[model samples]
Target: MSKKLIDSGNNAAAMAVQLAEAEVIAAYPITPQTPLTEKLSEVIAAGKMDAEYVAVESEHSALAVCIGAASAGSRAFTATSSNGLLYMSEQLHWAAGSRLPLVMCVVNRGIGAPWSVWNDHQDAMSQRDAGWIQIFAKDHQEIVDMTLKAFRLAELVHIPVMVNYDGYYLSHTYMPFELPEAKAVQEFLPPYDYAHTLDPEKPESLNTVTLPYARLDINGVKRPGYMDIRHNLHQEMRLAMEVWEEIDADYAQRFGRGGAPILDPYCCDDADFVVVAMGSIANQFHVVVDRLREEEGLKVGVLALQIYRPFPTAKIAEALQNAKGVMVYEKGLSYGNQGALYADLKSALYPYPNRPQLHNFIVGLGGRDIPTEDLFQTLKTACLNGDRNSPEQADTPQWIGLQL
Candidate 1:
């Protein structure tokens, strides 16, 4: 039987990692993310989890260690946040390019320079092109479930997977969840069987530098060059979409809960207006949608995106096709432009004949709390102001609750 427990999102994530039976864990201390790795370390010290925990000095080294472990055919785990994620940028690309089936948790936080240890999507959004499959969780339960499924999906495609949850939002929020048994999790997620790995008996070179042009080796075998390597990576990522769906379906069968691998639509059908967002913020919109529908009799709905890296263009467009307007709420801005979520969503709806009145409201930056009243009021204003005829009105992102 599944156990009911009250715990923070970070604790849930660590417990999920434990249940997944990770062979190795290497992480650096960074706020928001620090609690996650710290919990894992405590479990390791207590001899509860059978894993090699590496105390790394830096985020780059932490991921580098995970890369090495994954290459050696070990299922590895790690966690990081904010600038720590940026510091591991070089290794992030390396892990994805090498096709290491590693799973890492990103506690979403605002990037530094202004130096704020707060919540935002800027950190993960900046690394969207890094070739890793990124999935954002809306709540504590999804965070645990997604982290477990991440390992399965990553191993299936031999591509690294990032299970992202909002910093201080889901990461710090305490909630009740029915925890899955370790035995059941093991059954759902079989031992990771890497197709190709470092073996001592049969030595093989991996990730060797290649010239720009394709080349024929000494054995007269045609080898793909640099361009081919990158092209294959892109193709593999495209394949991950299908694999992700399969994994989510299987997980639902075992756990009695289905995770929204691509997009989570809330009361979208028969609704004229839809609010689109990601992470924990999207979860809040669900409640708002319910209240608006109940109290004001508005046809407002929510389409929360779970997968960000793949962009889920078709799924998102299909979900919003009937809506008269779309309000994109984001915690991160593109700096001098609009929010990244708004930009991608706009491009997705461009080819459609009857596109909605799209509006982007940038909000909740640097850990700003968005109360229910603020959300309802802001969205009410959006619904009133959004005009499909006045396209220029929705062209740029509008800052919400900005003191300026």
Candidate 2:
């Protein structure tokens, strides 16, 4: 039934997983991500869900349990935050290497030394190379919708997928969202087909013993070789770009309203200047773009990145084909650099003859609010000069909502 209800992003994620009908769930919950798995546990206790709830001691075992569940042909999921992600980091790659279509939620949060419970992208970005098909959610609706889609995509491609959303911003924030009809989710994603299930009657070995660096020849002569498992995983990650988009196109046609993009565009066709961003910051920057356009009559656009991992370079370059300049807004810094997204965008558009000037603007670090006027001012300043490398620069992330 199409219906409206308010939900915190974490709760919505748990609800999505239940509706998706995963067979097993395992996790060592951390803050922000904790309430998500906690709700799942409650659902399990109340007989609402018939999945196995494996309460492991550490994040390592949580993911280990997921791999084990998936190996036995059970659709599985888990959720974690910050250090928990890094703690399960090794298992993340293992899950992918074993070709388990495990879907996990990473409530985006700041990583700590002094310790923090706030929101940031450091955790997810730190685990970026772990071979998970990463998708970022801007709002609670995407959180719910994308979590369900993550499972289907992971199963189709035989790779692990992580749906990342900001901790306090999305996880705790309430917003109106409609739960998709069961028929819609069912049609969108059928049941899991296990070609390698570990059934007692038809027993098969799981991510079993492999000699560290050994290969057997046809003549039974053993040769040495490292685990090239990562190579295969890399290829599958690349394939996600095609499979996910094709599936999303179908999904939008059937169930989505306007539908979100791997890179959602806002006025980019003929705009000379564009502001590119990802996650929560993108939503704020979007409002800023509208004001700049309406109030100042400037030709500007906003390109919000929904898919962060496969980086979506080709699409970005093509979309910004007419863009003369770009201001990149990022919540997390690249450390020793202005912005990570800035560096990546610059690299992606490197070969273009008429590419953008690409000015890097870092803002909203550690739960800071990014205002429209700050973006308006930054865009105005970037417009005044074409030199992105000028020594007397206009802004230092332009410090939105800050004291001079």
Candidate 3:
């Protein structure tokens, strides 16, 4: 039987990495993610986990070390936050471009200039085009589950996976979860078996710039001008979508775990109005949905985000089949537009027959607490007005729970 214990999200992530059977862990300490590294080290020191914890001097070297290990055909794990992730930015491209399967946890935080440590998606969004597959967790359980499941998906598809959760929100939040048996996990996740790995006898080169031909090559065919590495990365990422779905299916079958399962749908099946959000800020929307139904009988649903980089807008459209209105309760604003995920969502609904009024409700910036009641009132007001120009109108992002 699995044991239930109260632990922080970072601890849960460390446990997931342990269950994933990572052969090597290369990491640098960063706030909101330091607890995870500390736990990994404790387990390593106690001989509880049979993995190597690489003490890198910086985030770049941390990921560089993970790349070396993964390229050597070993399962690897790592964690970073904010500037730490930015430091390892170049290697992030290299890991994915080389088709090395590695799993890393990103404790989502704001990028530095003023150097404030708070939860935000800006850090990850800046690297949105990075060849890595980014997956977000709704809560503590999903945080742990996704972290372990990420390795399975990454290794199977030869892609790097970013198991992302809120900085202090999920990273520091405490919750009870059943620990999966190590042996059971071993049975589910096979050892690393992939191509282009560094070997003694079967030595091979990966991600090398070969003179000029490599610059202008289209699938090995020399084309015109400019090195289109980004284009090639895009193509590979498109292919990865299919690969990711397959992995998720197999993982579900082997592990027998489901939440909203892959994606959480509150009342999208029959409702006309919908609210979408990700991470812990998303849960507040659920209570609001329930109250809307029980008190006013308003037909509003909540769609919690599980994966971000993939941007499940098609699924959202399908889920919102008869929906007449939509409100995107975005926590982290994308500077100018205010609403970060709104544009991608709009693009997804562009071809839909009944394109409902979508409101980009920005809330909980700078680690501000979002109360359920406030979100309920905000949704009610936004939906009533059918705020068509919400992306442009409204006070930039819909601020909630603020005194000023």
Candidate 4:
């Protein structure tokens, strides 16, 4: 039987990690993410969990340790935020390129220069091209469910997975969520069995230097070159979209929780305007959508993205093809360019003949408060006066909650 309890998101993640039976956990403390690792340590100390907790010196060494553990066919895990994630940049590429099945929780935070520890997506967004699968959670319930699904997804595709949630917003806030039985979770997720384990008896080089062209090995068997290997990784990531859908369907059947694997749509059918976002901000829009429909009589809805890395281009286009307008609210941007999701949405709908007019709004950087009134007003204006023919105006991103 499942138990419902009120707890912080960090504790929810820690509980999920224990339930998943992760063998090795190597982590360093960083704001908002520190409590999660600390909770795991306490659980292990109290004899509630049987696992190896390796305390590392820096974020770089944290990921390096996970890499080493995962290579030896162990289910490895880790967590970090902001600069800590940036410090593990080199290891991030190494883990993905080597095809190690590792799962990590990234409590999203803003990058430092001005030095503020707050909620934002800039840290995870900056690492979008690192070849790791990324999933964002909107609440504490998802923080637990997604973390469990992440481990299975990573092992299935042999790629690292990053489960992202906003710092202090979902991380520090307490909410009630169901924690599933350990027996059910164990049945849902089997033991870790990697195909290629680093065995001393059968010595072989892993992730060695590759030539520009294919070469014949000692047994006269053909081997792929550097470019070919990278292309294969890209193909596997694309296939992972369907793989995740299957895993989510099976999980829902067993635990009665997860059906929508790719995107979660709220009152979107027969709506004229749609709001697109990720993480906790998407949940906030549910309130805005209700207000717009009840008070303003606008047919507005929301589409929350669950998977970010694989892009889900075809599914995204199918969902928004008939809408009149789409407003994308994001917490991170591409510096001089517009919001990353906005750019990707435009690309997704480019092929369709009757595409929706798209607009981008950047909000809640460095833990700035995004009032529901601001969201309602901005979306209200877009529905009333959004330009359908002006492509240039739609391309520019407008900043919300900015003080000058």
Please give each candidate's TM-score.
0.97, 0.91, 0.91, 0.99
lDDT of 2 by residue, 1-404 (tens): 76678988888898899889998899897998988999999999999988899999999999999998889889999999988998999999888778889999999887777587788888888887778888998888888888988898899989889999998889998988878887778888899987888899997666666666778867999754445665667777887888888878877887765355588878777788988887767777667778777887888888888887878878888878788788887767667655667777878898876676777776656566666777778777786564655543522344456655
The C-alpha stretches of model 2 lying farther than 4 A from their native spots are 200-204, 208-228, 386-388, 391-404
Candidate 3 lDDT, 104-126, residue by residue in tens:
99988877787868887777877
lDDT of each: 0.89, 0.82, 0.79, 0.93
Tens digits of lDDT, candidate 1, 1-404: 88889999999999999999999999999999999999999999999999999999999999999999999889999999999999999999999999999999999999988998999889999999999999999888998899998999899888899999999888988998878998999898898777678998867788887899999998999999899989998888887888899888998988888867798888988888999999988888877888888887889988888998777777788788898889999988788888999999989988877588888988888887788777887777677667733667677787777776
Residue-by-residue lDDT tens digits, candidate 4, 183-247: 99999999999878788987778889999999999999999999999999999999999999999
Can you tell me which runs of candidate 3 are displaced by over 4 Å? Answer: 210-233, 259-262, 388-391, 394-396, 402-404
Local error of candidate 3 at residue 152 (angstroms): 0.9
- Stretches off by above 4 angstroms in model 1 are none
Error of 2 at 361 (Å): 2.3
Best by TM-score: 4
**Which has the greatest lDDT?**
4
Tell me model 4's lDDT, rounded to 2 decimals: 0.93
